[model samples]
Target: MAKIPATIVTGFLGAGKTTLIRHMLSNAKGRRIALIINEFGDLGVDGDLLKGCGDATCTDDDIMELSNGCICCTVAEDFVPTMEKLLARDLPPDHIVIETSGLALPQPLVRAFNWPGLSTRVTVDGVVTVVDGKAVSEGRFAVDVAAVDRQRRADENLDHETPLSELFDDQIACADMIVVNKSDLMESEEADHLAAVLKADARRGVQVIRTAMGALPVEILLGQKIGAEADLGARHEVHHHHHHDDDGDHTHEDEHDHDHHHDHDDFESFVVTMGEIADPTAFAERVADTIRQHDILRLKGFAAVTGKPLRLTLQAVGPRIETYFDKPHAGPRETRLVVIGQAGLDRAAISAALTA
Candidate 1:
C-alpha cells in the first residue's frame, strides 16, 4: 500500500491559511485531495467557506473539520480516529491537506504522524507556515526581549512570554517552508525585511515565498516531498521548556517538553453583521480604525458594496486591512465580519464603530 502524503498548513490568525488551502483545492488538477480544517472557534466558518468552492476535486465528503480544540491538543482523541477513517476508506485520498487553527503548533501536530497507526500509512509532505508580512514588519510578534526582561523583573506578576509571540515563533521554527503572505500590503523593503526575519526562524535551506491573498503556484505549494515527519528532530521549537503562569512566575527550564497544551480561551472572537455600506473605502477605513482601537489581532469577512459586481472581502492582520473583490454572491449581500483578539475586547464598541 502506498503511503498517503499530508501537508500541514500552520500560521497566525488571519494569515490566509484557509485561502491558500482553497486555492490548492480549487486547482488540484485531477488529484483526489482531502482537506481537514481545524477551527479554534465554535463556528466552522473556514470549513464552510471551502465547501462552497464548488470544485469537483473537493466534494463534501472530502472535507473534514475538527473543532472544539486544537488538533495538537486533541491528537489522540480527534486526529487519530479521523485519519483512521480516511485511510480505511476504499478510495483513500491521494493527498491530504490540514489547515490548523491559527493558534496551533505545527511541530507537535506533525509529530503525531509517528503514531503506530499512521507512521507507515501517511507521511507529512511538508509544513507550510504562513506569515502576515505587514504584521511582522510592524513588530506585532517581534517583542524586545531585553525590554520584556526588565519589565518582568519590575513586576513579579508580569509573564515574560507573550503567548502570541511564542505562538508565532513556534510556527516559524517548525516550518519546512514559509510563505510571507499579504506582501502587497507593505512596501518592497518591508516585505523583504519580514521575509528575512521569517527565513531566519525557518530551517536552513528552507524556501520562503511571498504572496498576496495566498496566491502561489500549485506546483510550488505542493509536491515538496520533504517528508517532514522524518525530519521533525531537526526542526527547532522555542517554547520547548518554559511554561509560565498567566500571572507571572516564569520558569526557564531545559527539559524537552513534549506535552504541549493550548489555551484557546485566551483569544476571543465575535461576529458583526450589517447592511450594505455605500462606500467600501470609507467602511474599510472605519474597520481598520476599530481594529487598531481595540487591539484586534484579526478581522475578516465580506461586505456588500453598492453597485459592485463582486462581494468585497475584507482581511485585517493587526491594523493593516486589505479589501478585494473575491466573487459574486448567490444570495443577498450584507456585511459579516468576525473579529478575533485577546480576551477583554469591547465587542459592542467594535461593532458600533464598524457599523457607524
Candidate 2:
C-alpha cells in the first residue's frame, strides 16, 4: 500500500495557520482531506472554526482535535492514537493535514512520523511554516538575522534568545516551504525584503510565498512530495538536542532539564464566556482595547449579537482585530473568546473589560 502523504502546518500565534488550512479545505475540489487540529488554549476555537467552515471536504467527522496539549508533547498519548483511528477507517482520506499549535516545535512532531508503525503508513509530504508578514515587518518576533548577529558580537555572554524566537526558528528550520501571510498589511518592498531575508536564512531550495488573507491555491500548498521525515538530520532545532535510546527511539535532553522549553511555562491561555454582545463593532473595539491593555498575543471566538441572527466571529492578533458574521447561531447564544499571551496576564481585569 502506498503511504499517505501528510502536510504539517506550523506557525507562531495568529500567524494564519488556521486561515491557510481553511482555505485549503475550501478549495479541496472533491479531495477527501482530513484535518488534525492542535490548539494551545482551553477551548478548541480553531477546530470549531474549521468545523463550521461549511466545506464539503471537511465535515465534523473528518476533523479531529487534540486540545489536551501541544501536539509535539502529546504525540504518544494523543497523536498516535488519532492517526491509528484514521488509518483504520475503511474510507481513509486522500490527504492528511496536521495543524500544529503556534507554540509547538515541529521537529519533535515531524520526528514522530518515523516511529515504528507510523513510518511505513504515512510520509510527510511537507512542512509549511506560515510567517505573518506584517508582524515581521513590525519586528514582532524579531527574526532579523543581521541584527541578532551584531548583538551577539557586541556581548559574548548575551543570550538574546527568547522562547518566541526559538519557537519561530524551529518552525522555519523544519519547513520545506514558508508562506509569508497577511501580505496585504505590508508594502511591496517591505514584503519583498522580508521574503529575501527568510529565503537567505532558510535551507537551500526552500520557497517563500507571499499571500494575503491566507489565500493560496491548494496546488501550491500541497503535493510537495518532500518526505521530510527521512531528512530529519537537516532540519536543525534551535531549542532541543536529541539522544537515542537502546530501543532506537529518540529522546530529547531538554526534556530532562529543569526549564524544559516545550513545557510552555513562558505562556498561558484562558477562555472568557459571557452573554450576548449588544454591538459587534463596539465589542470588537473593546476586545482590541483589552488585548492592548493586557498585552495579549491572540484572541478569537464566536459571539452572539443582540439582533443579528448570524454568529459573529472575532479574531485579534496583536492590535489588529478582524470581525465578521460567519454563520447562523447553532447553539446557545453567548460570547466566548480565548485570550493567549506571555505568562502573568491580568486575567481578571481582561475578562471583566471584555464582558463589560
Alpha-carbon runs more than 4 Å astray in model 1: 141-161, 240-356
Instruction: Assess each prediction's global lDDT (C-alpha) against the native.
Output: 0.72, 0.74
**Candidate 2 TM-score, C-alpha based:** 0.62
CA deviation > 4 Å runs, candidate 2: 142-161, 241-356
Q: Cα lDDT for residue 148, model 2?
A: 34
Model 2 C-alpha lDDT per residue in residues 149-230, reported as the tens digit of each score: 3433343322334345665777788988888877767888998899889988898767677777676667557767788999
What TM-score does candidate 1 reach?
0.62
> Least lDDT summed over 10 consecutive residues: which range in candidate 2?
245-254
What RMSD value applies to candidate 1?
17.0
Clashes of each: 0, 0
Supply the global lDDT for candidate 1: 0.72
lDDT of 1 by residue, 46-134 (tens): 77778998999989999998864656557788999999999999999999999876555787788889999999999998899987777
